[model samples]
Target: MKQTRTVRQSIVVSAVLLSVLFFLPLAVIEPFRAELFGRETPVEESEPEVGKLDGEVMLQVLNGDMVEEMNLGTYLMGVVRSEMPASFEEEALKAQAVAARTYTLYKIETGGNHGDTADICTDSTCCQAWISEQSARENWGDQADTYAEKIETAVRDTDGQVILYDGAPILAVFHSSSAGLTRASGQVWLNDLPYLQAVDSPEPEDAIPNYYSRAEFSAEEFKSRVMQAYPEADLTGEISTWIQNPVTDEAGSVETVTIGGITMKGSQVRTILGLRSACFEWETEGNTLIFYVTGYGHGVGLSQYGANEMAKEGADWLEIVTHYYTGVTVGPYTPAALQAP
Candidate 1:
C-alpha cells in the first residue's frame, strides 16, 4: 500500500509539472510574440497562405511590365510572414515554403542579381529637373538599402524573374510628379543610379529639358514673366528664348520664396515658379486650373511615403500591398503547382 501511494504521488507531481511548463509559454510568450516579429498579433483563427500561381501567370508577370520599384527582398519577407499563421497550418506553410524555394531558383537562373549599382543620381541637382523633385530625393535617400531588401524578398517570394536587356537590369522606373499619366518628366535618370552633384538651384538655366511638353510652356511663360518684372525693356524675338538662355556676368534680381516651410531665392519670375505660384496655368480635367499640387508622380502602384505611412500605422505587409495595388491576389508562384500534376 505504501509503495502504490508513493508511485501515485510521483505520477501526479509529474503531470502537474508538465502542465505548468506547457501553459507557461502560452501565458508568457504568445501574447507578445508579434512584438518581436514586427507584425500585428495573430488572430485566434489561422490565416492560410494563398495557393501557388500558375506558370503562365508568373511568365505573364515577368514579360509584362508589372513591377513595383521597391526592395524585392524586404517585400518577400513581409509576404511570407503576413500569409503565415503563428500556430502553423500545414498546407499553408508548405505552400509558402515551396514558393520561397522556387523563387530562389528563379532569381539565380534569371541573373537578376541585386549587387551592382548602375548609375543612380539622387542629388537634388541631378533629379531637380524632375516634376516631383522632392519626392525623388526622399525615395532615393538613405533608405535605399531598406527598399532594396524589400524588393529582393519580393522577387524571391514570387518566383518572379527580372529581364536583363543588353547585360543591364531592365529598369522599371518609379518617379514622383510624372506630368499626367505619362512617366515623362522634366527630370529623369538611369533607374539604378544614385548620387548627383547639385550644379544650381531650381531655375530655368539649371533646369533640365522638359521631357513631356518640351519647352512649350516655358517659352510661352518666359517673355511674359520677364516683361512683368521689367516692363520698360526692349524685349525682342521670343521671351522663351531669353528664359532658356543663362543670365551670365551678373546675378538677376533675387527674391525670397517659401515651399513647405523651406525658404529659397531666385529672380522674381524664377522664385514664383519655384514657389509654384500661378504664373502659368494648365487647362485640364473640367477646365479648373488646379494650383495646390500635393503628390509628385502618377499616383499608381506603391506610394513610397504612403507605404512607409502604412508601415508606421502598424499595418502589415498584405495590407500595405492591397491598399496600393487593387485587383491583385497575393500568392506564391510554383512550377509543379502550375503544371498539370
Candidate 2:
C-alpha cells in the first residue's frame, strides 16, 4: 500500500524550518545570553531584577493557594520546535505565555489553590484523567519539566505568598486543554445577583485525549463506555433502569430533579464540586449508560491538548493560551518580598 507522503514531507519541512529559523537565531540574541553550542551563557547583568511581591501578585499567588513557574526559554523552545509554521510568529508565543500566567494567577486568587487534591486516578469520581503521549514524554518531557522548575524557582525567589484555605497550600496542575465544561473559579457581580457558576462544560477541542477524536460514539461506543463502568450488566431494558440510576452499594440519600419534565433519581441534597462540567455522555443501550465523553480531565485553565494541536499547526504558546482564557496578561515576578515572615 502506498503511504501518503504529503504529511510526512510537511513534518520534515517543519522540523527543518524550526531548527533553521528559530533555534539557530537564539545564538545571536545578546540579551538572552543563551549559548550557541554547549557553552554556558551567564545570566545578563542588565536583565530586569526580580521584583517584590505586591498585593496583586500575592493575591494572585495565594488566592487559589497554588503557584507554578515555567522557564520562558524552555517553554518557548517547546512551542518553537514544533511543526508550527514560520508564520506562527514570536508575538503569539509571548501572548500565550501572558495568558497562561494570568489564568494561573486568577485561579490562585479565586479558588484558593488545589493542594492535596488526589491524583486523577484516585479521585476519578471528582476529576477525569488522561495520559500524556509517549512522544510528549520523549520529545518534550525534560524541556517541560525544566520550564516548570524555572517558574517554581522564580516564585520562591520572589517571596510570593500563596493563599491557603483551611491551612492547605492549594492545588496547581498544568495542562494543554480548555477551561472545564463549568465555571469552577472567578466571580462576577451581575446586577448584584452574585452566584457561583457551574465549573463544567464541553471540553475544549484542543484537549481531546491524545487526539482521540479519531473515534466517535455510536451504539458501539456506548457499549464500550458502559462496559468499562459496569462489567456484568446485560444490555437489556432491565439493565437500562440500572444504568439510568447508577446506585452504589453503600447506602445514600435519594433525591430527584426533573429534566425535561422527566424526574430522575440521584443522590439527594445538591452538591457543587470543583469546576462543574460534564463531558461524558452515557446513553441507555438497553440497560447501560452508553457514555460518549469528549475531551479528558478537568476542563479548566490551559488546555494542553489544544496546546498540542496548535503546536502541531505551528501555533506558539501565546496563541494557544489566549484562545482559551479570554483576557489576561503575562508579566514577570521577582523574589523581593516573599521572604519568610
Quick one: best lDDT, which candidate? 2
- lDDT scores of the candidates, listed in order: 0.33, 0.35
lDDT (tens digit, per residue) of candidate 2 on 1-341 = 13668878889999999888976766567545544345575566432222344222322111122333323222222232332222323433333334333333434334423443311111113222212223343654556555433433333342333322233222223333433332222311112111222222233454343422222334454445445544563544343343343332111112233222233332210121111122332345443233343344333444444455455667655454435443432234322332224
TM for every model, in the order presented, reads 0.25, 0.34
Cα lDDT tens digits, model 1, 97-190, are 3333333334434443332331111122321111122333355477544543343334344443322233322222222221222111111222
Give the C-alpha lDDT of model 2: 0.35
Best by TM-score: 2
lDDT score, candidate 1, position 150: 42
Question: What 10-residue stretch in candidate 2 is worst by lDDT?
Answer: 267-276
